[model samples]
Target: MASGLAFPSIFLLESHLTEDELESLKRQIRSLTTDPGKTDVFLGKLSNRERAQFELRRLGVVTVEKRQSRTRASARADTDSAPNLEESPAKRRKTGARAPSPIVISGSSEDDEPVQIVPPPKETDTIKVVKLAWFTESVARGEVLPLSDYTVYEGRRLLAEPAIMPSPAHVSRAEGILKRAQADAAGSQQPQGGKPHFMQARRKKFDGMPPPRPSLTRMTTSEKERVENLPPIPEFLHTTYSCQRPTPVHGPNDKFVEALKTIRLARQLMGDKIGIRAYSTTIATIAAYPYELSTPSEVSRLPGCGPKTAELFREFQNNGGHVREADDDEADAKLSVLRLFYNIWGVAETTARSFYNRGWRDLDDVIDYGWKELTRVQQIGVKYYDELQELLTRAQVEAIADRVLEHANSIHDGFQMVIAGGYRRGKALSGDVDIIISHSDESVTHLLIRRLVLSLEKAGLVTHTLTLSTANSERGQEAVSWKGNAPNHGLDSTASGGVGFDTLDKALVVWQEPMEPADQEGDKAGETQPNTNPHRRVDIIVTPWKTVGCAVLGWSGGTTFQRDLRRYCKNERALRFDSSGARSRVDGSPVDLEGYYGNDPATDMLTAERRVFEALELEFRPPNERCTG
Candidate 1:
């Protein structure tokens, strides 16, 4: 009787239902022990078969009409029921049927009929569309009701299945495995005395001694040599603080580091923030390693590299410098399309995934199907996707930096600038340019980004401004003040425009150099000027003189180095560091590390930056030696 009340997997159609109404129905469905899935029964407000089919198709479900012939349907059901003999006991229990006890027949043959474990009709791929009132009326009556009157459509699924329902092939394989396990257990019974047969076999395998662990026995020639002449581990590597280490541009294990970077990129595209952080630490540690990697054990010895990291390294070595997961990630059709969308200037991982889910396979699809749904910045990004992804050579980057600096000084004289990011890290090419600008006077730096952007735009050097954050200036050029150790109390939420760390007044813009005079001198008959310079992405950050040190240090280091620097400050020094300034974590007081070099307001920006390193009790790492990417 209880088995008669079991409902097939049911899916709720979101169309034609209010949010609250949908949630209410979902709660009732959950109370009835019906979980969400690709289901044979679809409950909805729909009343017609065509409307039901349209709703399913709209949600990416395709179906076909079930055969109306009773004989054929009965034959198909019989064939399907035979396979149910392999269904797991757990699923049978879920359907309110008791699992049968295992029977061991002495002379049972392979050709014998399969033992039925439960008494219940098997479910099929035939779908039925039931009106919403059926569910509500059934819940009101406090008993499961028949669906014959409420069902509007009946069809065979073209392609869909419940996720938890194992295929017949899988069930067959599982049964075989279970038989093998039972046979092994029955044969391995203790023989009258000492130990089990398996235990005796293990003892005889290694001459009565326990076998050596796999890791210790798999050393290669280079690994053996590396062990013999082990290099002195750098003292800084022991701390796990990237700020304490010097990470050069080209490390001894750069090739391996680059390979790991591919995996990190995949993690980023998948929006796995924790995985990204973990891989970043490992990548940074490998990038800073002084010796070449010969074995997985060598990687395992590093601070952040765990056993999994070492195993991946071994796999990487075996695959001729490629990680299998990274290769698969790159080759995945969905991920490849996602990567294309992610490379667009303003599209984040979430946005890229959203675009893919919307059935937009490419940029053209996005433009065609969802152009109006995009933000202004995203539209601009799509408009210049190829141009934005083009790499900028060092010379071109320098030119852009020079132009930015010139524009900054034009808005307010005596502005000092440092070209940060990949260019400062000695990369031959950069995807974008990051320039940090500062003025000795706080008043000059306050709200300076707006004027600078206006100046650049006026000169036709700036095409679009994506973001203009003045959170630092809004807070009167102050650092984020910390609250006492109470959750959600006294924190300065307005210090930064976005979340975490950085709060400097900055402008994220698209830049294109103005046409040269020679190119501007086109035919006198009103020909348009040819702008040969390619469009480039640029970030201009403005910082007050007092906290210029923090700005330079924060903006110059690689992503991991900057992240670990802030982490080190919080954990070791009880302070918070960001592009805005430093503040004591214990209380909400600012920490002035800039004035240590000199009382002079006009001190050189590099000297101020060095003063920060000295005050933080860390060695000053040159920009080129801070490439922990």
Candidate 2:
């Protein structure tokens, strides 16, 4: 019976409703089920009202009431009394009755319900009859509104107020005003009396007739003012010390920094120490800057940026962030010398230039003509020149660290190894791998580096030992006395301070990966086998458990960061900083920091480092944030 209720129309109406509208309809329907009179006050459009009637009928809560108009009654009398042909299957179900068999209207039995009569078409009935049904249902539901108030567009059933069109007179006046505005704009662009303005006249006279081409350099007054009045450089950009600023692991001013670095390198090559220092300071400052700079003026106000530096920046800006190589013959020659000297492991700018003055041009030249003059370390450096120059990838570093750990554990259990240096600081490539080994028991690390290297060498991992020093060796005593005797010597002293806290037991070695079966086969077949996998430089430093934190912190660095850390310790805390441990300057007593590091073996190194900072009243910095440019 519910099928005759035109329930399909409700689905069609739902298809057009938005989610929010559907939810609202659902709420209204639920309310109507409780209180049928609620549907009577729903003031929605005819479509909504009819939709509600269809839903109510489907729920078996409402039945349609037929009306006997004159046209409908006449049509009904003419039709044979079967269910009306115009009645849909859905309408038949609404009455809770089966369709009747053919019978005369006057012969219909009282047991059969009367079906709705179909209305005949009228000449004045321009509106669709289905729409009239919706209107009638809306009225029954008490959605009372004037017929003239309803407006629809296209085929959509919308409820909107009728639009009012503007009068023709008002439109004409608007058009007149638009034409006047266009005329005024055209007049303003032309000179008075079609004669040139004073500035134009002067430009024409002095320039001997202006060029026919349009000028691209011209700017309006506002644009000119904006160019002259840029925002001031931020206070943070005024920093002169790298340690005071927080430089991210990566930055936006890479192009600028690269250019400055190249110039600094060139200066170093040219043996201009002062120039190198100046450029380093400026490069560090720029690298630490947070924003990308577009104009030279943006950096003109920064410290360490002199007139020459400013001009270089402007030139770089003009060249689209690229720096061209110097074309001067003298500069190029000096650069060549600088490159040659800088590549030698033990050679500094001073030594490189001295060799250059002695007529050495290339590594071959140095070997052939001055090999005898080279130090033993420099000789080894030349022998493995190509191998030492190659950078170590993070993966290779980790593999080496694993091998080191394997060797350390063989000698004693519970030994901890940390891969420090640039690798620890998150650099993708490093010059060498630095490994620090320690154990909770101090006795385990007494001769750790020496025993570890012997084991690694026996296993064919360590190819050559470049240096080996034990903690109790006489060399350590000599190193200590060297520093103690020279109180006024700068931190750059290579004999003592430059050896990097010589008290710690350490070794430097050349390492190579073990040859696999495939590599051995290739070597036997003489198939131009790989060049022994290029010997890599590795440093192994063994420290007692108590000082492992200081060792890790000291060795993990960007060079400038280490320098500043030592400077801070010396100036601010009156302490001497070193990889082994920190000691008081007054009486050379160890500054106990054991309390900060709890007894946990896994986290003791980190905890101890943090405690060192706390003990010294300094803020702790993470490895990445300690870039210091």
Candidate 3:
């Protein structure tokens, strides 16, 4: 009987474990579930009676033992008939048996040994299927659902997976939907045919809309007061980003923009680069405004306008639509220096200041003493200073463009050219003509700048080459790639303004219209040479046919407009925009615009430009409307 009796054994239950312990126990249970033989060694280590109890525990059987003293043990010989506590709780309840109490085991070795118990099967509650109407109602009420309520499932099981939150694209879509709905609601609220008198009165009161201004001569006292007290236009009419605004070639606020731009230019002339940038944003904003401003309140509503600008606008209004100018000896001297510095193409405010500090006063002083110190490009700039200062008429630029195109096509039959810069933006006159050249045959684009300039120079159409650098030449391989008017010897060779201004294969030349046969005959007949045709500045940029659109777009800039476009591409599309091409910033891969709008670059350049906008997920703005500055 003693041999058959089982020694006391401790049993561990799932309810007794902590969260971390339960996790570890579950892992162990999964291991056993896959291979039941894994528990053999653990069971073999126990004593015979303990092993029997562990086996019973493994089989979901429980045992309880009651101890009696040695003297009382002989009196009770029916220990085998003792009630079993190893029975399931259901069975015990049915037989009117009390549940077993928890026992504390005591022993140094017993503390390390715990009996493993399988957890009972969990009961799953049926999930309520969510209806689509609930989502619609929540969205209608502008209520966002709790994050936890959103769940992802795999087949029938509720997966313990993370939820994908809404992205910017999703939020934009939602906002668009809401705006359309609001517009619809407003449309429905309007009365059919004619509005009721009360509805019209309500609209007049709540709209905060401005009434048309009457002529000063015809205005009644009450009407004048009403016009003066009207609220400024809504903020939505103005946008923080200049690229989103439409600035026509000729704007209603031209005078205000010009005045602000003059101040900005003065700041630049005084070497105030920070001030120049500050004024640039505001000037661009004012230039894009569609209406001519009449009050300080109107200027105050613009995005970049500040107190100073508002005050300036009010002063302009008081002075009958003109900015007040100051006349002084000191201002005249500075203006002279500003005009002189501006004539040098490669020189900026810092370089101009450097020249000023060196005690150089005028163009003659630069020509006499500072001639040797000037950069090769600056030397050419000073040589043709007066000629370059003269703005070219649209007809002059077009004729030059046509001549260049004729020369280019003469060299290669399929060559293409686009007149960019201010001319492309429909300006009546431009400071200079910028032309972008390309060819469907990519191999022709490799050294096209040198080839075309050489052809033009031979034809006597090009007066002088200020700069003719291939892509490799600009990148500092002048020894092998440079082919232009200036010698490779003693070149500055460093990048201008830190990074190179542009990366396209390009040439800047002094061009004069070829002497017409009549003019040439007149020259031979000594008719004073017809004013010498005044050598005008021309820039020729060469690019591959695939990226000619990018070159044209980059070159046809209203300075601030180009800056904002590049910023938008970088921040919104993860792209790097340049004259050469647009590329993904992520992997440095060239982004092709052809697939975006199904346009062939080999045919139409404007279509290609439109495709670039589409590929970047940007709205296509016409060139004339891009005069942001």
Candidate 4:
């Protein structure tokens, strides 16, 4: 129904329904599967090529063909003869290969052109999922682990202190200090009898301050008895959205991390006494929260800010820009190694430290010094550091997702897959692909990862395999509870259990590595082999349809969104989740996937996710809107 449904060429005969509309259609169809008629009507709206998406969404499948008729009427007419609910399975079957799949295209041409690529096999191996963990002892030890160390991204709330309005007391103190300073100047410049003037107490005023009263925060006798006992902090909550910690920012330059480190260290030394503060956690969010500004009120009426603080905030906003100083921090940290370390897809803090101990200070140095320490993804990150960081094109991501989805289908029935992460957020380009897959057959599921990897590798489409961990994954945060420096988490940090996951359907893991320029490959020993783009990290997750929604929601998040969702679910909902299962209060421990959510074939990913949202008591977020900052 939308424009731009043109037929490209003979090879790309599929209608060009601009990828966004198509992916959206996929997400939508997956959401509404209860009605066969609705499914038909939805599919019936699209042209033949567009219908491919609907097919894929319904069955984890799709097929492609050469250019076909452009006339809308012809497509409309054909829609009448399409698959119907009443058709028998065998009769309904279409010629699998009589028609080529539209999804088989990879960017590389078949000796075709610079940008044009032949449709490779519908399978690929360069995608994978790695289960992650960090120890409690490791966190407490200040092990400098990856951001994966902390369990809770719990931010202290700036509560509107209705009862304990402590601000006036502080203001009174400041006013007293001002009065004392005036008196001290008026009386004597020198300390009186050598007693410091700053030691003097401030005068109190009876002005607008509220009446002194008993603390309302303390519960009344009746209220205490009536209030239900709330759960504790740091407990694991059952999450429909299983939290998956993300890989840290990496770069090719060893010096890059060093620079960041050195600068941070210098700030601690200088700014600590001088109050130097870390600005943006990542280079990405710097503009939103700067290092230093006088004050720009986040809201018109901040809790602590009286008229004066409000004025100051407004003045700061009006004057020099940011709340935090962006560029002024000393770039004292060495950056070469940081840059190099940045490229390693899953490089944790400990790993980064290992790189540092080895004395690799720069990208060139890492190449020159510690090549062995680098993972395939890191090497790729360095090689194409510039390119990988560049946002992915909408078209490019969609094409790749198609291949991965098809591979999931090949694994077996009850097997499901979906693309999550940034691309799911509707971004044209993405950092890397995030995929989830799952199925009911345990044995067949066992074979899913290996077969997928082998198939994809044999196709010559996947260049390298970086890491792999099968699902039923126990690789969640290792510590009982992350108490010290660790990554942020919501679902895992309930007062109940840890993270909820029984056995994942199966997780197949692979990573993309950077490909050297054609001419440059001659320099490396193993570089000449095709498909091995060293250092680009990719992940594939497999989950049963029962937990597919959890996987999708978990993986479909921006960093903070995941944290917030978990916070609300675990803290507010009183459910406990661990990496392997969910805990219920009426019962004893975590519930198995089948038991946690009832059995239903239609309880697949897109549908199941709706269930999770319903449990969370929130609106359903389509893939595009899911990427909340």
Per-candidate TM equals 0.66, 0.57, 0.58, 0.45
- What is the number of backbone collisions in each predicted candidate, taken in the order shown? 0, 4, 1, 104
Ranking by TM-score: 1, 3, 2, 4
State residue 296's C-alpha deviation in candidate 2, in Å.
2.5
| Per-residue lDDT of candidate 3, residues 1-629 (tens digit) | 11222211212233223355545434433222322222221111122343334343464432232223365565465445566558787766656545433332221232122222222212222121122233324345555343223311101111122122333444444554466457656775633344222121121111122433332223346545755876565453465556666778888888778777777767777756556777888888877777776666557657887666777776676677666652231266866686587668778777887777778888888888888988887888898788778898999999999988888888889877789888888989888888877777777777767888999999888878877777633543211221221111211111122134447677888888776676655456666555467888788877777766776777766777777776687668866676666666565566775552245453767776777777777677788988876
- Model 4: per-residue Cα lDDT at residue 449: 64
lDDT of 2 by residue, 346-420 (tens): 677768788888877888888999999888667877888888889999999999999899889988888777887
lDDT of 1: 0.74
Answer with 1 or 2, whichever has the higher TM-score. Answer: 1
Best by TM-score: 1
| Residue pairs with clashing backbones, model 2 | 1-93, 3-90, 4-90, 4-91
Best by lDDT: 1
| Cα lDDT tens digits for candidate 4, 332-381 | 24334443464455554446556767777666776787667666756655
Model 3 local distance difference test score: 0.60
How far is 595's C-alpha from truth in model 4 (Å)?
Answer: 8.1
Which 10 residues in a row give candidate 1 its minimum summed lDDT? 488-497
Which residue ranges in model 4 land beyond 4 Å of their true spot? 1-295, 298-324, 329-340, 353-359, 374-387, 411-415, 440-444, 471-536, 578-581, 585-588, 592-597, 601-603, 618-628
> Which one wins by lDDT: 1 or 2?
1
Give the distance in Å from residue 327's predicted Cα in candidate 4 to where it truly belongs. 2.0
Error of 2 at 164 (Å): 90
Regions of candidate 1 where Cα sits further than 4 Å from its true position: 1-217, 220-222, 483-502, 521-524, 530-532, 596-602
Off by over 4 Å in 3: 1-238, 324-330, 472-499, 521-531, 596-602
